[model samples]
Target chain A: MDLTPLFLPQSVAVIGVSSSNDRHPANVIFSKNLLRYPVRTHAVNPKGGVLHGEKVFPSVSAVPEEVDLAVVAVRAEYVGSVLQECIAAGVKSAIVISGGFSESGRDDLQTGLVDLAARHDFPFVGPNCLGLYSPGIIDTFFLPAERMVQPPKGGVAIVSQSGGILVDLLVKFADEGVGISCAISIGNKAIIRERQLLEFLASDSRTGVIVFYVEGFARDEGRDFVRMARDCGKPVIVMKAGKTNEGGRAVSSHTASLAGDYQVFRSVLKQHGVIEARNEYELASYCEALSCYSDKSIEGRIGIVTGSGGHGAMAVDACISKGLSVPGFSESIRQQLQDGFSASIRSIAAVGNPVDLTGSALENDFVSAVETLSITPEIDCILLLLLPYLPGISSDLGASISQVYRRSGKPLVAYVPHVEKYRMLIEGFELNRVPVASSIESAVNMTSVLRRCRPC
Target chain B: MLKKEIQNILDSSREVGWVLEPNAKSLLHMAGLPVPRYGWAENIEEAASMAAEIGYPIAAKVVSPAVVHKTEVQGVSLGIDSQEKLQEFYRKMSILPEFAGILVEEMVEGEELIVGATIDYQFGPTVLFGIGGTAVEVYKDVALRMAPLAPEDMSSMLQELKGGKLLAGYRGKEPIKFSALTEVLLSFSDLLMDIAPFIESIDLNPLLCSAQGCVVADARIILADQ
Candidate 1:
């Protein structure tokens, strides 16, 4: 199916627009595209008045120009007719933002829409979704723009099964200054599925990494998903839910018991080199890390340089649990690190795998340690546990670490606790392209993802 | 092309149940899977002759289409070193209503492993590997992949098992040759792919693996209703 109009429409019509009520979802969507997207916006209302100083046509067929796409935000009872009108008008595709279909015990309504779309031979998104976002081209999210946080434009593309989760993720991306090429919410997935989006995004020049929040897979699409993932030539990360009672609970046979639906799904995803994130934080962190360092090769071996002993131990545990090795530095690398530090700092610091450059350590101590470890042949990646509370440590230390990261060409992830005052210190590392995580565990998780990324 | 034995099995299976022993062994052998030397015996004298030919300390089981679990029905008897013992076991097996004949075969003792294929609702033609023996149901230690599986996939599937160390020669035992195991798994995957339409599932429980090689000790091929 050609998804051009659904994502990159030249012109869009918002059906069921309420001219008088500015807060209606259709009106908000109209206002949002009018102010931002380059595409021309057309509003349709049966009343056929003016909205935002533009004429509101009585229906999509009455629109002046060819409608590339239509956003069906009309009432549930009238959604099928609106889609019929759209089909008649020769609109290429649509996103049905109206709710109350399958999600609200209205299977008849949902089936009607599905049949209508099939008859028209056009692709459409959900009858209960926030719709699609194509960076600067079109965004059909009807939530008020003031309440939404837009992420900077970059390489990650997100496909979600739940709108609320997508919204939360976008806000997190915006807060972290992480950029996304596109974000699509595929609620109910009556027709369009992640597999379709995956095929489209695989060739998309803008998307370097693809992430999905999937509740379940459609009937036989799991195999195709795996095949596509293997051949896509891009990193695919998935967070699949509904495994508790996903499918086939009352099964017979040892194969059925051991290879239950979820277990097979998990194993297949892993076998195809798709990273599976367990939680929202891992999803966000892995996305950030992969987006920034997707081209860099990171082996599972890690070299840790920390300012706190306890945090260092925790980072070691976290990395080891995730199949990442934290090997001790060889004598030559250890000597170079020890020689680079000052005598007083050397007396207090532990120059080993988790090179604990203690609280009394100065800025040069971190710079030298990272520089030494980054050049070490045995080290594949570096984890910097930066504690701003250490009086000798400050935001300037991030630049030195970032410089080594650039020169060394090894992946680096920083962990800074969420101290209110340490915001700039965290940004200091982030602004330099060093992905920072809020906790040690998350940083290690991102490191594991980077290790799994296909080598450039 | 499927062998004549499997073609006949497919032609005759009218309901959803386990295929008979001769059909199962024939299909396994036709797919290039290793199985102990064996032959069907219609009478006690034939059973004793086959046991002697296969060389002593043999295992014998009643071949019945109606009885799916031979051990539960006391249809199986092991360690028959003499002709008298073999004849006695064959006579005991012949009285059962479902008994068609007796299967006389060489005995194989080694670490047990389970391998199987099932048509998953979501992902079709999935192959499985796991720890086996009587504890097959109790432990349920297994890993799965969609067929047809590659060599690396077979190795990783074995690695995923909880008792995976047994394949690597656990407890002073020589490591089972991985090349031989890989061939069995690859052939099993090919067979599942080939007859995917006619079969519901295939279970080769307690596949014996030792320093020498691996063999399908017991097999059950469940046919989908025609």
Candidate 2:
């Protein structure tokens, strides 16, 4: 499946532009693509006069020149006709952003569109979805720019069943400054499903890690997913929902009961080297870490360098709970870490495994400690818990820390929690490819996954 | 060897369902799986004689198409050490109308394990491994793998069982030879793969695993409808 046109389209046509209301979803998507994205956008309304000062084409066929992709934002009733027009106009890829299809109990409409897409052999995203948002390339989410925040462009591609969940995760990722490769809302999965997208993204240079938020799988697609993920050679993270209550909820065999379909799903995925995330937070954290340092592999031992003793203890507990080792720094490494800092910092901080740099520790203190452990044979990875409220620390410390992290080649994840005020420092770390987790638990969770991750 | 034996069972079958004990044991043995020594005895005297030859400790089970759960029907007698005991137990069980013959077999004592294969509705022939016994349904500590399995897959499946630690010698008990268990799992997977189309389900309930090696204590193979 050559999905290049679907993801990398140069020009896109929004098929249902409302003439009267600017609040219409189609118009909203059109305006977002026009103002923020690089793709050329065309508006289509049957009563065509103008939309956003660009001449609205009466139909897709009426649009001048070839369009690579079509965004079908019309009502579910007229979606099939618009698709036919797109096919007639030689459009190869499309995203059906309309609702009232299968999800609204209109199976006939969904089936008709599925059949139409099949006959044309062109891939379409969804019938009731937020649509595709390939950062810098295209943004088809109907939600307006101000309301729907977009994460910076990076290497993690998200394919989710719920559009609302995708938006929530995107907002969080944006706030944390986690870069994204593509965010696809595969609602109803009418035409293109997870397997096809996974196959496409597996070879995609832009996508380093593939994350799935699936409500359910279609029959044998689960088996196909496992096979493809094994061969993809990239880390695949799945956050499967409806697992606790879905298939085999009333099973007969103890094996089937204890190893329910969900357990089997998890085991099979893990057996194939796919990381399974238990919740939305872990899914996002794993995506951030894996996308940033997909090339590096960590093995258990983590070096914790934090500004506060309380945060360091919390991180240690989290790591230990997940079967990760937070080994005490060796005598030589400990002595080196202590020597790098002045007496004021050393007297206040604990020079142990969860190396507490104390509240007064400065930027150079953090850099030197991390730089030493980065080369230390015992430490497999590094975690920095920075609380910028301390008078000695400034956001400028991010640049120096990021530089030291890059030079070390060890997987480094930062946790900077407070609120929106710390955005600059967080962005500074993320800009240089260091993912910042929201909490201590998630920071350790990401560390554990990265440690177990073996690059194929 | 297995192909010829399976063909014979299919040719001689007048009805479908559980394959008879002799046939099931023959299938297992042909696939290089271990089964306790036993024979179909024609009479009470023959049952006693077979038990004496197989050794002092043995068991006798009534084999009949009407009785799927033999123990539930009170059709099984265990620990027949002497001829007097064998004859006495056989007299009580052989009177049942469903009794086809008496199967005198060696009594295997070890940790109970269940190895089963089913034609999954979606993934096709899948093998299951877990602790066996009546609590098999309650303590559903099992793992499944699509057959035929690789060597490593077999080991991992065993390791995944809730009772996996028992095989590794828990407490003061000697560990059941790991290679022996692996052999049984691998052979079962191969057999399931071979007869997957005709077989609906194959269960080796209470497949005994001990320091002596693994052996099939009870075996049943359910055939699919033509």
Q: Which parts of model 1 have CA positions greater than 4 angstroms off? A: A19-23, A100-112, A246-248, B1-5, B42-46, B87-97
Model 2 DockQ (Cα-based):
0.32
Q: What is the per-residue lDDT of model 2 for residues A1-456, given as tens digits with 9 covering 90 to 100?
A: 468988999889998899899999999999989898888889999999987789999999887878988998888999999999899889878999889988889999999998988987978989888878888899888888888787888888999999999999898777656678999998989878999999999999998988899877776677788788888989998888877745534432333344455656676777677899998778878888887888778788988999888899889889889889999877888889889996688777778988888888887888888888889989889999989888888888777889988887888888888478887888788778887888998888879889657776
Q: How much lDDT does each candidate structure score?
A: 0.86, 0.83
Give fnat (model 1).
Answer: 0.56
Predictions in order: chain A TM-score: 0.95, 0.92
In candidate 1, list every pair of residues with a backbone clash. Answer: none
Candidate 1, B94-177: lDDT as tens digits: 888777899888999877889998887677889988888767878888888888898789768877787898779778878987
**Second chain alone, TM-score for each candidate:** 0.95, 0.94
Segments of candidate 2 deviating more than 4 angstroms: A20-24, A45-53, A74-78, A104-109, A246-254, A345-349, A360-362, B1-23, B38-53, B61-77, B82-103, B118-125, B146-148, B154-163, B194-203, B220-226
Instruction: Quote model 2's TM-score for chain B.
Output: 0.94
lDDT of 2 at A360: 86
